[model samples]
Target: MLKFQEESLRQSVNGALALRHQINPFLDAIFEKGITNICFLGIGGTYASAMQTVSHMKEFTSMEVFAENAAEYITTGNRRIMDGTLLIYSSVTGSTPEIVKAVEKAHAAHATILAFLDNPNPHLRELCELCISYPQNEQLKLFMAADRILFLRHEFDCYDDCYENFDCYLADALISVEQSSDSFAQEFAKKHCNDTLHYFVGAGNQWGSTYSYGMCYWEEMHWMATKTVSSGEFFHGTLEIISRDTPVTLFISEDASRPLSLRVAAFLPKICANYTIIDAADYPLIGIKPQYRGFISHLVTHAVTNRIDVHLEAINCHPMEIRRYYRCLEY
Candidate 1:
């Protein structure tokens, strides 16, 4: 509870859920025009979140869905981005130069562009065909949009029931998860605060969360050195570097790729003494259905890790917001 603001968190979650009304209608209008493919574009953390979204969408639908790093997409154009493509984007500032340039190219290609903005910027709003401003929870909004698309395509029959649960119970469930996971996060942070390097591994839907935490949170925010890899690929080359003293954290989710993380968990104890496992199944989701848990597994992992972030900040006396060269200098 160091920096937890209960009311603010509740309001943010509720605000995201409330956008479902607008999201569905907006998606419906676009679908009526007929889209041949869907593309998600972003940078850094947003790119990581898009990875999870693309992964989740591929599971249930056969639609051509993919994600691209805006920086890379602008450099090496994707052939799939064409006249019938539906491009989705998300940003906190809505002014990232790479994203703006990429959007311009997509627009010229006649792709219908939609953006989710955490902060309002008239320039970005004018560029996007449609823009929705929300408090936070970009991941949830992405999932909602994906689910609505699936429903419209006659692929997701239970979308309404699942979203109803999300509206009624998700906020409280996430709050409970934060409260329950705080102890583990505190202990993990205290033990690893001074570690020189950290290895993060995860698979399936949680891979994006694992990557973002290691890169965006630990490296960018905390100024720590970390390497993130998928659990499925750990044994390929990353496992060779593991030793008893090496710090490693594995994230496990309830998706089909859960077995990949389980395989890593089985091998870690035999060689590495310093290993931590954060499993979504260990936490209770309250009213969320079992079948839909896989879809939101990344969100649960994020909630758990948010506690680790705060604890690490407090233990190291390093504010999470302070930066040396991130936004302060020209890159």
Candidate 2:
């Protein structure tokens, strides 16, 4: 682990596992009260995680789910959002103005609020009907919350077995990702150290990872230009931008959407001279079951791609922690 703290990562996994107790009771109370729809509302990475969870849930469950941008949802409300809605808001800082406003609006509408926070503001914490504070594994918290909701509603029959294996599977993800960092990810970073722009492509649940990496990691952290497109949408207009010199990165997951990534892979090599494919299938999983691979593919790809950040920092002579305009300036 080059930039990762082992204790912090272990603590995060344990913290997320402990949330099952808290989440079970919260869902018990919500189902007793009756919830009609689930809405995951946030900005940036939080919202992207919500979208990924929504896609994951839709594979088996028939629940009404929506992932919305906090600021946009406040301005143009969804008709399905009412008193019976379960609104989930994720923010580590809890000081994000847009999320705070979304909480207030949901509260006024009598919607039930479930928030994942780190050191949340007193006002924001008070507003939530149920709050889970775990700063390290925010994505895991969201995924677990969504999965629990599905199980509670009687959508996922095997949820108990899945629940029992949460800690083990997540630990596997943390470990496998570190192993991947030392191998393919480091090589990819060193190869692309001089590249200024990148085009990212993914499909299914991985589409969220592509978007999150492009915006949160590349644009926000590295101050680089990145264009992320879904594999299905890459042909419509995005394919025209592909040239012999384009720096393209493709994310291949082992889900039902593997065919979509395969299609892109088949086409890119024929046209583009500079392109790299990072497939999650290449990673080894010691403890994870074969059936769970699709469910955990996003985490594996995220772990692999994130390793490049540390390498890019060393090669490009810019620390990933340096941000010029995120919180330092007014938006």
Candidate 3:
């Protein structure tokens, strides 16, 4: 049972990475037009992926990036959907109704549709200008999406060595995988499972990190009540939730988001005995050898995020089929 679960996890990672491989060239072609603006239409894993893309594209390219939430896109006004925009649509199964509608809107406007699809969903392909297959998960498919960012932002040849070791690294993501280090998280989860509220703390881009791990995974694995507010956000209003009755998990990024993640980490230990703090520096599961540590960290974090996603689907009837639903809803 565990082995099957592990394969399921690795397959999700491998499947998403494969989609990135196909999407890169198409993205290159669209960017070649030197379009001034970029728009991403998505939610959940797709939204998370779009955020990473938005962050990276800003640092490396001059394009103005905007991400429209899927809900808004489903009901947006025609003029509100601008022209000359590069619409990057992400639907893991290629069948989100809102995304499909967004794609149609972009089509009517003559916008370029660069999609990340995991399967051969014909309707999505028919709607898009370039429909490339890439798996972005429903809740926490950030790891695979992070790699798609790296592929677009950095030198591919430099990181080509990275994919070679992915199978081995992913194997470790399962309990038998090398860096499971399951004790701390398992014990911490046990003590706080019944606790109704929890806070996820992280600094830098680590906000995304903890958001994926603490909120996404907890929601999947144990159906734990999780709120994914950043450290800064945590200190804002919800910090009142920090108490003996409410446990917290602090997810910090090493070089960035640190000052805030650490600051929040320091504050929570004082109020909550059930508090558990995990510094990203001490965790190697987030480390993907043969690549830059930052890239590896994002990829490893993504794998764990995806794993929790698989575990959740297994326990529930929530099959990952965003594409299938869209076909029914659209036509």
Candidate 4:
């Protein structure tokens, strides 16, 4: 466990569960006033996370949910972002320029804004109608909020049963996944440490994790070149580019799109010997219901990949926190 802190991880997961108490009440209040649609607006990693939520909502709930890149939303506004829309956002700094501007636009449109911030930014706070400062597990909190909304609408009857397990056992289950996946992660780091390019593929709810891991972690943090594609779209143009030596990883989850990833998994072995498959099914959540595993597969994927990130940092001798130009100069 390089750079691992068990207590901190446990606390973060537990704290996210506790935050649900605060979140549910606020959602209840907002629903009373009426909400026509839900819009998830964010930048970079946050935007990808919003995509995961929207994907899940599409499968289980009929709610009009949209995930938009904050910068793009500012350029071409969405007609759905009007009076009764509830705009949801999550940010580490809470002051990204694009996000701030997007929030301003949503505010002017008479949409109610709710933001989850990792750090307090008064300026962003002033723009949001409801802002909660939670330093970790923002994705989990976002999913919880989404589920709570669905529960209130009578769309998710198992919400209470699912969250009861989340509150009591999710942290331990996630930690167990980290422990179980550590050896594979270590080997993965050693094997791919110097690879020039990485191609990641995933489907369903796990697609966001695949996208974020490629762009945010491998590219931004590790300074490695990478490309991500959804499993459903892989054969469109991406499949021909793969050769036997090309490094590819497929993330498989228990959602409806699992078959798409499985299709890729089956094809990769015939053409590419360097392919890796990280299946959420391999790690069983001891206390979580079988029906709810799809909802938290992204979290499980993170727990496994977090180990790989630490190992990669050690092998590459490049600290994960260092960036050459991300925030060092203005564009």
Candidate 5:
């Protein structure tokens, strides 16, 4: 009774859309409580949480806001927190050593600590004044992390125009992707013959799309060295290394992202041994326009890579022998 095509689509889109509803209320609560100069820290997939926070908050306040590797803050000691700084963390498991240590340090320094943890992990509770737990599954944790951004943006109370514009972005991203599972991995791998490196690039609020599994998936699953950079950097400098033997996967979306996608698409033939351009121009998410078709395409790309990992594992081919990567995550 379950169709593979429809089933696959549902899986991907639901995975993408679920986060908004789950995370928004928690973050909106934080924003309403009046925290200024917020910094978020996390590891791995949790990193996306910080990205989502920055994307929404950037519109509301420019007050020295950014997210960085947690370790970066840990080394500086109390100096990391100014009079107004409030630190929040997202660690799905409530554990990732560096993040845990950093949260402890922030609390010791008298910085307010808020944590979005995956469970009622005792370590997380001890280190923060506020510990918020969500469903612990990989997909749902992402939902909570993402929705926090929308809530935070609303709390910051941007000017009417800025708030409206970001809301549109949040709406499109949340509504557009539906759960689906069409594996495009074989199609991606089929293009590689002698083996080659790939670079994924994106900019603006969507730039995090480049590194989402692009670099890590290649190294962990495919045993390839993939590099991800911004479109401008790839054009100005990295383009020199690109040639007929190099492979490039270009993501083109509709939202304020067309020119760069087109530029890369136009230059593909001259610079690569192989090139694939995904047209995210007409994806059927209710909140997104056709230009943002790239989201569904991005899902397909990630699915394909994981599928190929499964095949490689079946054949005993992965160099790292990364058996089901998550199961191998060292914590």
Candidate 6:
């Protein structure tokens, strides 16, 4: 709890839970229209988290799903995002220019848009057929929205029973992550404050955390050099750059790909001594059932990383809010 606010986080979690109700009507509307494919679009860290959520949807559901960068989709264009496509947009600020443009493009293509905006933007909300506003924790809101859609479509089998216990599950998840903030994150930050150019790798659904932490936190927020490699692809080319002094981190989840992450965790310390592993198994997920750990592992991982970000901010003598280019200067 070095730089974290417990009450604020609880409120954010509650706001995310409220999205379940806000998103149900949209799901009903889209299902009635016979949603053919789904597209998740956002900019920056939102895009990174979307990749993980899309991976989760793809793993269990038969629906055609995609996660796209808002800016790149504008240039390349996805043919599948037309007519019956259920397009989801996420913008924590509701003011990212790229997201606003992507919303317009998707709307013009006649896709039914369900946007999760953290802040109110009338212009952007007008572009969407349905919009749900939440205060913070945009990634969790978007993931739950996607899960709700999958649940309504009978695509996510664990939805009905697991969802009934969601309130407890969510509260426990946040608490477990809170408990680790002081122990793991603070210690890690203290030991590795001077290291630059970090390398992070994760597998399966957890790979999204790898990308988000490296891209959004390390590189964007902390202004440090970092590379995110998928666990499956790490041995292919990324391992060649390893050195004893390299600051390599591995994110492990309890899902099916836990073994995949374990593979890297075992290999990294053999050649590189400066490696660290942050696995969800280490945390006490109080209210979450053992069988459903995989589904919420991303959330837990993200929460822990949030702690690390704050600790890094304190140690580096730089606040996480400081940015030189993002929203500070035109691209």
lDDT at 78 for candidate 6?
A: 81
Error of 5 at 9 (Å): 9.4
lDDT comparison, 3 vs 4, better candidate: 4
**How well is each residue in 178-273 modelled by candidate 2, as lDDT tens digits?**
665666777878887777789999988898888999999988887888999999899999899899999999999988889999999999988899
**Model 4: per-residue lDDT, tens digit, 102-134?**
999998888988889988788889877888898
The ten-residue window of minimal lDDT in model 2 covers 172-181
Candidate 6 stretches with Cα past 4 Å from truth are none
What ranges in model 3 sit over 4 Å off? 1-21, 56-62, 76-81, 134-179, 209-223, 285-291, 296-298, 302-331
Report the C-alpha lDDT of model 3 over 156-244, residue by residue, as the tens digit. 44435665565446445433421353344344434554556666665444554566565435554445567777777778887876777
Write down the lDDT of every candidate, Cα atoms only.
0.90, 0.83, 0.57, 0.90, 0.55, 0.82
Error of 4 at 31 (Å): 1.0
In lDDT terms, how accurate is model 5? 0.55
**Compared to the true structure, candidate 3 yields what TM-score?**
0.72
**Which digits, one per residue and each the tens of the lDDT, describe model 5 over residues 20-88?**
453455555655776656676766555654654555456445455667567766776547464446676
**TM values, all candidates:** 0.98, 0.95, 0.72, 0.98, 0.69, 0.96
RMSD of each: 1.0, 1.5, 5.3, 0.9, 5.7, 1.4
Query: Candidate 6 — worst ten consecutive residues by lDDT sum?
Result: 163-172
Candidate 2: which pairs clash? none
State the lDDT at 299 in candidate 1. Answer: 88
